[model samples]
Target: MNENLRCADEARTASVVELAQELIRRPSRGGIDPYGPVLGVLEEWLDARELPHRRLRDAAGAPVGLLVEVPGGRPGPWWTLDACLDTAPYGDETAWTFPPACGDVADGRLRGRGAADSKLAAAMFCHIAADLAPRAHELAGGLAVLLDVDEHTGGFGGARAYLADPHAARPAGVMIGYPGIDEVVVGGRGLWRATITVHAPSGHSGSRSTTVGAVTRGAHLVRLLDAADLPGGDDGSGFPLPPKLTVTAFHGGQGFSATPDRVDIHVDIRTTPGFDAHAAETLVREAVTALDTALPAPLPTAVTPVAAWPPFRLAEDAQPAAALLGAAAKAGLTVRAKTAGPSNIGNLLAGEGIPATAGFGVPYEGLHGIDERAHLAELPQVYAVYQRAVLELLGR
Candidate 1:
């Protein structure tokens, strides 16, 4: 068990670190983004290594993602390792102490936009594949490394597109490299988005006979939703997950004088397993309809479903989770597991019934905020966890 997965010595470690820095230097917004200088650099690196892979493309011939495969000498299920390629936009240049795209390694940190949110782990996975390629015969199964875009913007188009690609490997299990180094996230909250549109006859604010103003009524509905006792209320008797409801956007009244006739209130709700997106929508519509009884005159209201995605949860007995926990125990690292928050890709996989999926990676802070950073020295430990997890899950 002491067989170290930190196979990269000083020079190799330096090389991987350098590659990660170079990747951070390039800016990739998302799948729809036309600018992808990072992809070119990655392609060159893969070419030099002569790795077997494919560029997943959309119908219009645009690159959505890259899937690299290393086949094992023996037969076993394929394990898909993922780290998103697209990094969130660096908010303000002046806010950053170190230049966001400089990819500087200073103050004991790899400082850049994607330094933690995950270009580092992506680099580590590529290097791991290089290390494992020559020793493929020793592995009991094959491996596919997926570096994707379309995660940050919540489209998850990269994963969806790649899943449809005929050449893409159908992963028997999956691993995502995210921030929390000392944690292995087991699942995430689900999301439901909808708009409540109100249609009422317009009138002058001074002479309106309307009992409930459009904006005021919308506000009232917001309070109702917030106060409603939804399931998964941290009771500890259930799943220990809480429901989330928020009025993201409210539009009504123009020029601030005339009594507004139409109003639209947009809401984004997060749900747990017992309370799903569909269930949330139903409850909201029913409550909205019930509000009519309290009104002096019924104002027609419509609740339109914008979009929805179910939450993802992996059972404790799932193979990928077991492999990760076992490796962590062997490494003597205390790692906690829980469902963190809202996610798109994990939900997609979980909805599709893919339970053998888990997430773990190097620690970092300020995700989607200023001055994001992660420790290069910690890469070896985390890499060891990934390598061990892979071997434990895919090798046997």
Candidate 2:
């Protein structure tokens, strides 16, 4: 490894550790507004480094994005490294071994909510750009770092807003800093969030023969859904894509004494590459319609889509994918390309014709769960791999 590059890696690791702590200190739960201090700290760091950056804002004037651009001397492709600023709510803080925001460096690990999920990647990207600045004039392309504020809920607003900006230059390719060690993730699963509402006329429970209970109808629908089998496979190799359905929330009934007139079942559907949200919704609606026919009293049913994220798959032969493999090898890291289990902003970028991948950050387990943490020692290696990946994609 180059000595200067090694030094830059070490500095990046330490900086990300500190930055992760700073981000965790702010309660930037999804849907909740991000704390200004967190954005200010990141901006201040960029400004001090003399990096040209812009704050992407929404109509409400909320800070939705942070973009830093590293210009290249020669005209060429622009590459983007993106990370989300928002994190899931800290559940059961008492379950944590240390405070989520302590930014504590203990036993060669940094423990926090956003530590591994994305904040570490965001900080590391910044450091990598700074280190590459000395050689910017020799590089073949420009690099941009995009820090999005809304990812935990869905990246639709934050990501779409940035991509739609008239002044924003669309990069030839994008590398998303999700958690995946030095491995390149070339594909991701799709997401469909919808609510199945069952409705019936309210009546006395004693007269069950005349009145149809909404809760009962909802239960039937759930059973039908649970019993329904979607397409999936169990390829014993690794990370085989599987279809999943979950009832995240359910509510109905106004009072204990009355038969509930309405019941709502929130459904979360994860589909493979070939599945479309419209088709999935249609299947569910068909199931509900069939259930209504069998009921004693007719019950109205509807499937309402709350959000949809399409699945994305990039061919292994694509230039960006090939470049990632080559870069990882050059950086002395063994790499494999795979699909992500959950939906990510990579889906959006891939849809836009920018062959994108996720998992350019430090590897960590237990994401969105208690005891979330990232390996402190491995981040430098990840940074090196990403640095090489960017150079390879830009043909430097």
Candidate 3:
């Protein structure tokens, strides 16, 4: 990195660490209050710099989207840099080696909830915007910063709401700051949250086969689902491919004292680019129906789609992808396109024809779990890479 870039990177490092702490301090756990303070901080920063931005409000007047714009000298393809604001709940503070919101920097790592998962990316994007503002007039396309309020619970509410609004800003491409270690992630898998409920006539524990138990029926259904082969393919392959699915959660039964009357199983299905949600749902319902057939008395069962979000894959040769690859190469790293299990805002942008890719932040381990961290030492280097990528995309 050049000396100017290096100095900027160094100066932003402390700010990034501080921003991470400020974000974690609020305990923003998939709710409105958690994001308010952070958004305030961001707005303050943008105002200090005199950067133009707009607040996208929901019907309730709560801030949902923070749109910061850096207008270019000439109008062309607009590029958007996005990061989700909501984070997973910080569970069991005792399980953590350090306090969840302290932003403890130790042993070359920054540890805290939302430190590595996503808040770090948000911070980095802020720094990128600050650095690029002075040179904004040199660029060819618009640079937009989209900070979403809901992602941990699922991004549809915030992203879908933004997509639905006719006045919402649209970008030519979007760069999502997901957890990536100098690698270019061009694709991510889709997610389907489903619930399978099995119902049976209530019966006493003494009755063996007189009345079918919903808990028993649900167990049989789980077995068949375990045996069923869901679709999947290579780990790092790009789009237009077979998707993958895994049963993440299953719940049924009440207590040993009495047979449960109803059982519900929760499943998380991940589909590839070309997979159809209806077709996947049909396959799962069929499996449930087959399992119901084996019971002595067929139990009333229903398979319902609780939530569905499609997978997204950007073309490898797209401008944003190429620009990110160039940035990685310039940073002395090789670009590798891969798929992520967890869904992100990339799904929404890519679905809208914006060539968006995830992974443009420092690498870390134990995301969405205890002891979450980001390599503090590598952050400056990663920042430089992202800065270069932004400048390249904006054609500065």
Candidate 4:
């Protein structure tokens, strides 16, 4: 590496790691913990650097995330670098080799809960925004570094707030700084989620009446959902993953003596372009209808749609993806465009008719699991790729 690039990498790595450690040490487990302390860490860092930023609030005026923007000299398409500050709840703390809040850098890895999943990326993006702010006069488009705290909660309040903000510039594309070095997530399966209520006649267990309990009906529904013939991926559609159906949760029944009247099952369907939300819903409703027909219930089954996001697959030549993929190739990085199995914020963006690249960062292990940590050896290369990609996108 040239002296300039080498120096930049060294400095960037140091700063990013330090900021990441500080944030991780604070413990911002999504929904379980208040976000103020963790958010404060990044806010303080931005304040020290004199970067322009503000809190993104939900409709109820609760801070969901932070937005840092660096506008360019000339008008061009706006771009975003997003990463979540909130993290998954530390499951089995005793199982971790290091404390969940250790945030220690040892064995060439940054060990912590949010290290791989996102806190590290948030720090990196903040530094990138700070670095670009001074050179904004030389670029065309603007850059927005979004540090979302509501991501792990599945609320995506920060992203929603940004998109809803009348004062904020509409981003032409977004690059979510989710960790994984090998693939640039260009698209993800969309989701159609709902709570299905199966109703049955309540009766005493001791009664001789042929009354079916909601639990039994719910089990039957689960079987039907599992047996439902969802279509596989259509190669012609360009989306590589098939539609997925998962019965995530079931709630019903109380005492063993009395049969419950109602049971609620949460169904999560991962949809593809070929099998979209509407198609998935129709299939699910048909299964419900079939179940109700076979085993008549006092009350009809109900399918309440909770959330829906359309699946999307970006072409290789698409903006943001094209720029990042090109930059990675130029940087001699083997990064392939990938469509993720699970839906992400990219799916939500797709619903808004906005394009986004979801994952591309340092390789890591134990994401959303025990010893979650990000390998630091590839930080410089990853940082360089993103920096190059952003510069290219901004017309620098």
Best by the TM-score measure: 4
What Cα-based lDDT does every candidate model obtain?
0.76, 0.76, 0.75, 0.92
The full ranking of all candidates by TM-score, starting with the best, is 4, 2, 1, 3
Model 4: per-residue Cα lDDT at residue 366: 93
Worst 10-residue lDDT window, candidate 2: 231-240
Cα lDDT for residue 305, model 4?
A: 99
Clash count, candidate 2 = 0
| Candidate 2 runs further than 4 Å off | 1-9, 206-209, 234-242, 296-299
Across residues 82-141, which tens digit of lDDT does each residue of candidate 1 receive? 888888887887988878778888877888888887788888888888878888888867
In angstroms, the error of model 1 at 3 is 15
Best by lDDT: 4
Poorest lDDT segment (10 consecutive residues) of candidate 3: 231-240
lDDT of 1 at 164: 82
Q: 112-214 in candidate 4: lDDT tens per residue?
A: 9999989999988998898898889999979999889999999999999999999899999999999999999999999999999999988898999887789
Q: Score candidate 4 by lDDT.
A: 0.92
Which residue pairs in candidate 3 have backbone atoms (N, alpha carbon, C) closer than 3 angstroms, thus clashing?
A: 28-34, 243-272
Which ranges in model 1 have alpha carbons more than 4 Å from their true place? 1-7, 31-35, 203-212, 232-238, 295-299, 356-358
Q: Candidate 1: lDDT over CA atoms?
A: 0.76
- Candidate 4: segments with Cα more than 4 A from true spot: 1-5
In candidate 3 the C-alpha lDDT for residue 98 amounts to 84
